[model samples]
Target: MSYRSMTLLRFCSPIVIQARHGHRMRGKAPDIAKSLKERLAPVILDEEVAKRNDIGFPYQKPPRSAEFNKRFDHLKKQRSDSSLEKAARTTKLQINLDDVKVDWFKTAGPFHIRKIAEHYGVYDDLFGKYAYFVPRVFLDIKFPLNEDTVYPVYNGNKVHPLQAKSVPEVSFEHKFALSYSQKPEENTLWTLILTNPDGHLTKENSEYVHWMVSNIPNNDISKGDQIVPYLQPIPPKGTGYHRYIFVLYKQDKKLDLSSMKVTDLKDLEKRTFSTFDFYKNHEDSITPSGLAFFQSKWDESVRDVFHKELNMKQPIFEYDFPKAYLNYQKQFPLKQPFNLYLDRYADPKDVNKRYLEERLAKTHPFEGPEKKLQFPNAHELKKNIPSWKKTEIRKERLGRGRINDAV
Candidate 1:
């Protein structure tokens, strides 16, 4: 065969032709097959396919039939009802103590007097007086005087001797009274805390804890561990009489004494104690059971006793002696009743009403003119006056007009 004829034959052979166009033909065959398969396939609905496959489509949702709509509405109602029930469960109601007869309060006795007598009765009985003749003016309304409650006893005496010359030693036996209703259980515990609220004579606020004991079983304070040792009262020479307050708390359980910051005698002076904060922090654990107090002034006996027993130096009379005391006495006279002293001799409500009236009168005086002129409308004024002058005149007229119209 001729070379030209052989070359043409080789190029035109079926196998050679197939190799050159095989890839393109294969690619077109898939597309053609896919189109043909789609045309011949069954018309399966989305719902049918989802049901058959047990699958959910993200973009395609099933038709909402009556049953579905009813179910959805029921679900919404249930959720709303659940939310309302949750709100009802979480809501708290405020209780007014004055409006309610609290059995606990009655069993506790006159809250204030019971507390004071429990702590100070010993000193008062020993000193042959009721609460050191604490003037009614000095007594707070929260702690009204109640003569029925029992008091504490110190060194076999009912009264607290205050004569500086015969200031009692720090080593004195102490006892407390049990409430008639306080039938102690196996878990009952008590705590005794002694504090001087007026540690800083110049300032009206200060706290000096003289002693603290905790975990006394069944109101037996003597059985408790003394967290802070007892210290004799030593008022600064010039700093008016100091009220040494003793308070007792009924503990629901043994306290975590180690958590207390003021654990030693040295820590007492550095402590800034708050009875309210203490009770708040331990609300679930402790309740105030009793309280008592006695006033003490600087005397030579107190100085000598403090020096011998505490090895503490006498506080120097930095400020004038008796002057500050006299001023306080004058400010809170014994003759003045507690309510009058607290009110400063005027009704606070009346004062507040007068102040509000004066302010309102000044803010909206009644003497202004009853009739006020109205300015021309902006559209009407624009026909006669320049725009700038119109604005200025409008502002001026508005300012001059009575504001009572708005009121």
Candidate 2:
């Protein structure tokens, strides 16, 4: 019977089973009928739609600063220098330097920490520039000047850029606290160094080591080894304001810097030191934690320091800043290109062999009326300077040099 039924089924018509909702049979995939490309195509999602709308970042960034500024400029309605002071007062970011707590030196939030760091140029003055490592610990500086001190900072009560008149004796002693330890046993060993970065501007301008104390078991100075005996600030005359920076590095163990100690005040080689180099030499064990700075200038005490302590005649520096060219004609607009020349215009110094050998020579003819300045633009050079402006500007002071650079 089964053999007869199979022969009958082969001769009969094939019966098709209709799947529900026009779907194919369970064994077949709907995409099997489509082309290979359609089957392999990626599915577009919400994220993809967002990407097509240029909503997210690009895969490759070509321009950084330019593109970033352009993209964010529309959002920057309240610029720092906006004349409309109340334009976005609600969104304005301001910090009160006076509100800093002394305990914040030991425990402060990141925002407060950054404010403190920027206020004192923690990175700029010491680390050379913004760097990977900025000292979290800060040295609490106390300079008993004639009128002001660096202690108990309050009400923007930090040390002023220029301290009142004071001699070397006022700064001979430095008070440093490694830890605000309530007990002596809780205190940690620390290394403190003070250096003046004003001698020469090339090597660092390298820091002139003023004072260094190492291997202090606690805040006590007498317990520490005086690596470089404390020398009072004696900035040479003519040198502008000098910054005396104090950096406290956390010591893992007591350092043996007795061999590097400087007993001779006249020894310039040992005195001219590099804080960064010293840090690098022992960086693995020490991390800079504290930073503070104060400005010092030449005082009469500097004379005695040079004569007695250093046993050398003090070097006098003369900063004869040339008088700036006054805009005598206030009626005229002097903010023109020719102002670069006129702004810094100064009288040429009297000298037979003044500047250029070719110019002012015996054969060099006297100035002609055509020697007048022919500036590229303006109401013309008539309103401003004539020729020899370049020569004159060279002799001008730095204040005028900025004007030249601006133009």
List residue ranges in candidate 2 displaced over 4 A: 1-100, 103-125, 130-138, 144-187, 201-204, 320-407
What's model 2's overall lDDT?
0.56
- Which pairs of residues have clashing backbones in candidate 2? 137-289, 137-290, 203-206, 373-386, 373-387
Q: Count the backbone clashes (under 3 Å) in each candidate.
A: 12, 5
For model 1, residues 347-383, the per-residue Cα lDDT tens digits are 5556456545543554545574333345434335646
Compose the digit string of candidate 2's lDDT tens values, residues 1-407.
99999999989998899877765577446655766788799877675433322111112222567657965884576454565565456666565563454434434432364466567554555554434244454444454554554333221233432342222221111233333332223557778887876674336457788888887765666777878877776677878667676767767777888777898877655687876568668877776655555666777777877787678788887668757657564435555555444334434432212333323342336552124234423322343664556434443332343323321
lDDT of 2 at 299: 70
Highest TM-score: give the candidate number.
2
What's the CA error at residue 178 for candidate 2, in Å?
14
